[model samples]
Structure formats: C-alpha cells, structure tokens
Target: MVTLIIATIPACELALSDVFASLPDIEIEAERIVKGEENAAMPLLWVRGVEPDDFEAACEADPTIDDLELLADFDEELLYRMQWFDRIGLLFQMLTNANATILEAVGESETWHLRLLYPSREHLSKTKTFCSEHGLSFSIDAIRNMDRDPSGRYGLTSIQYNALITAVDAGYFDVPREVTLDELAAEMNLSHQALSECLRRGTHVLIEDTVLIGAAEFNL
Candidate 1:
C-alpha cells in the first residue's frame, strides 16, 4: 500500500541550509522540482522575508548552489529557480531510490519539516535504512497508509481523524482534563500505548496541515 509520511530532517544536513543560514528570518519552500540536463534536479523556490539581491549574495558565496536565477518578484516574496551541486545526493535518493515524492518541505529553526509519499511501506523503510547508513536522522512524526485520500482530508488518516474526534468529544483536550489517558484508551477500545500513538500522530497531522508556520506542498 502507498504511504504518507510527515518527518523532519535537520537543516544543517541539507545542501541549501548553509546558503540560507544567513537569512534566518526567511521562509523557504521547495515549490517544484524541474528536471534539467543529465536529469539534474532543479527546484523552483518560493522565499519570503528576503530581498532577491540579498538572496543572490547568499547563493553566490555558497558552494552548494551551482547556479541560480530569479524568476519572479511579488514585493514581499520572490520566486527563484536554482540548481544544486552533487551535494544533494540525499534528496535524489529519497526521490529515486525509494520512489518517494516530496509533497511539502518547509525550512525553519535548523530543521526541514517534510511531507513525503511513497509507493509502499517497504519504500519508506528503505529510506530509513539508507539514512541510517549515511548517519542522517530521518525522524518521522506521523505515518499512515494513503489508502483513501493522498492528503488525508487536511493531512490526517481516518484513524487519526476518528481519534481526534473521540478525544475532543470525550473532553480529553479540556484544560482540566475531563478524561484520563487510560480512560480514553478504554473508551476507544484501544490499549494505552495504541491510544497514545493515535493522539500523538493525529495532533501532529492536524498541526502540520493547519497551523504550521510557512508550511506548503511542493507543486507537482
């Protein structure tokens, strides 16, 4: 079955991290990936809170960027098309080795929060193993079988959706805590561990899709 994963990778490990490290206030997203000669991966980027000239200066001094061009200007936001050097092999492996697709990527606070889709659970495992070998941390916040909607109705699985509703209706989210975790687990006919997973995964999905700052899906 196809799977959807929400994960985090440290920005320090990404090729463009050094380039944008100077612009800590800027928000960056991988808008889309366009194939170039020799099947090079070039990404159209949307960056906010930085002027194009400043961004240009940063890229010029960064060794990871092979080339860059400004594609549009929206006053506060600028669109850029850029190509990375061979340093971005990790990204290529995620895309081709496991046949995964990047749905979203947001850079902030020394981390890249990503939404990724894979053809199967095995593929995701392959990615994890690959990262382990490379000493790259692939931290998964939530994952589910993308059996119905790929985005999962605002990025939640059916189980997560139900879990949230059950928690809310049972007053699990109340300030005073109307229900205990164990009680909630019993109410849901799930083990305590299972209930914990549901709540944690569901909450992560809800926040990522709704309230996550500067989060956006990559344009396919």
Candidate 2:
C-alpha cells in the first residue's frame, strides 16, 4: 500500500503505459485509487507501484510536486489484507509517516487531504485507475484544520492530546463496547509505546486527583 505521487500535464488521459514501462521490474498491480478535483489541471495520484523506487525521479524533474510530497520509495504491502483492527493500526502509521500538514475529516469514512502544492495529471490518472480497479474511491477537497489546541492543560504530548481529542470529537471513546489499547493507539495515530505511556500517566493522575479526592468528598 505504498503511495507514490507523480505530477503530469493534462487533467485527463494519463499515458500509464509509458510510466509502467519505466518500472518493469515492479509489477503495476491495480489497487484502491483516488484523484484530485475534476476541474484542476493536475490531480494527485496514489498507487501501489513496484518495490524500492516508484517515481521519485519524476517528482524531482517536475517541480509541481508539493513539499508534503509522497515519496515512492517506502514499502506498504501488508495494507492489502489487513483486518479492521490491523487497518486501524496501519492508519496510525499512515498519519505518523505523513507530513505534519496532513488534513483529516470525519464527515464520511475518514477522508484525508494533503494540499497539493504541485499538481500532476499523469500520476493522478494512473492512480485513479488503479483505485477503481481495486474498489477504492478518491476525492479532492480542501484540507480541514484540527480543532484541538496544542498548549493544553494536560501532560499528554501534543499528538497524544490531539489524538484523544480527535477520538472524543469523533465519538470513538464513547463506544460502549470494550476498547483495546491497540485500537485506541491506531485511532490516535500513535505507536503502542506512546499510547501506553499516555494511559499510564493518565491513570496515575486519576488515582491521585480523582480517586483520592473522591474518597474524601464522598466518604467512601
């Protein structure tokens, strides 16, 4: 599920055959695809390209690529068959690996938008085609800003606090069913290690402030 973006001219009719021809070793298998706005000159592309390098050189040659660019060198294969829980875990990784400017929305199936500073039509076409073949949809919308303030009162780190707030905002924490730490971590876009630390610190504070204070308040 590694994503590599390449910017090309023209909004439609991407000559993918030429792009695939460049990387013959890595099979250009189709997967979930998506594209940018229909009217835009160049759209964003996300594809499961071949191993090692996908289109870094093309990005370099094309100055239209944005600073929060998707590098085509990393590996993201396990994402294909991951279960719902595993998918959540990977989602956290995706958020972490993504640039700080990553934009997220919860209105419909958790949409993420990375503002495209540089546009590429060829890459967008191929990636959209690939996603279509794999039954994934793509959209082009403005990136939304997170509502949580970073300098909050909690001891939780900025990301941890943001994650908790995001979950609370999304109503994930309000679910009645049992919530796994892994799942929470995944939902928060944090590693298990970080998630565990936050919980530990939170539990300690609760015991000191709430649990202890409650005994005195209620005479329990």
Cα lDDT tens digits, model 1, 69-119, are 888999988888888765566677888889999888877656777788899
Q: What is the TM-score of candidate 1? A: 0.69
Clashing pairs in 1: none
TM-score of each: 0.69, 0.22
Q: Encode model 2's per-residue lDDT on 29-91: one tens digit a residue.
A: 212222223311222334444443344443333322323234343465311210111112212
- Report the alpha-carbon TM-score of model 2 versus the true structure: 0.22
Residue 190 of model 2 has an lDDT of 81
Candidate-wise lDDT, in order: 0.76, 0.35
Report the Cα RMSD per candidate.
Answer: 8.0, 18.9
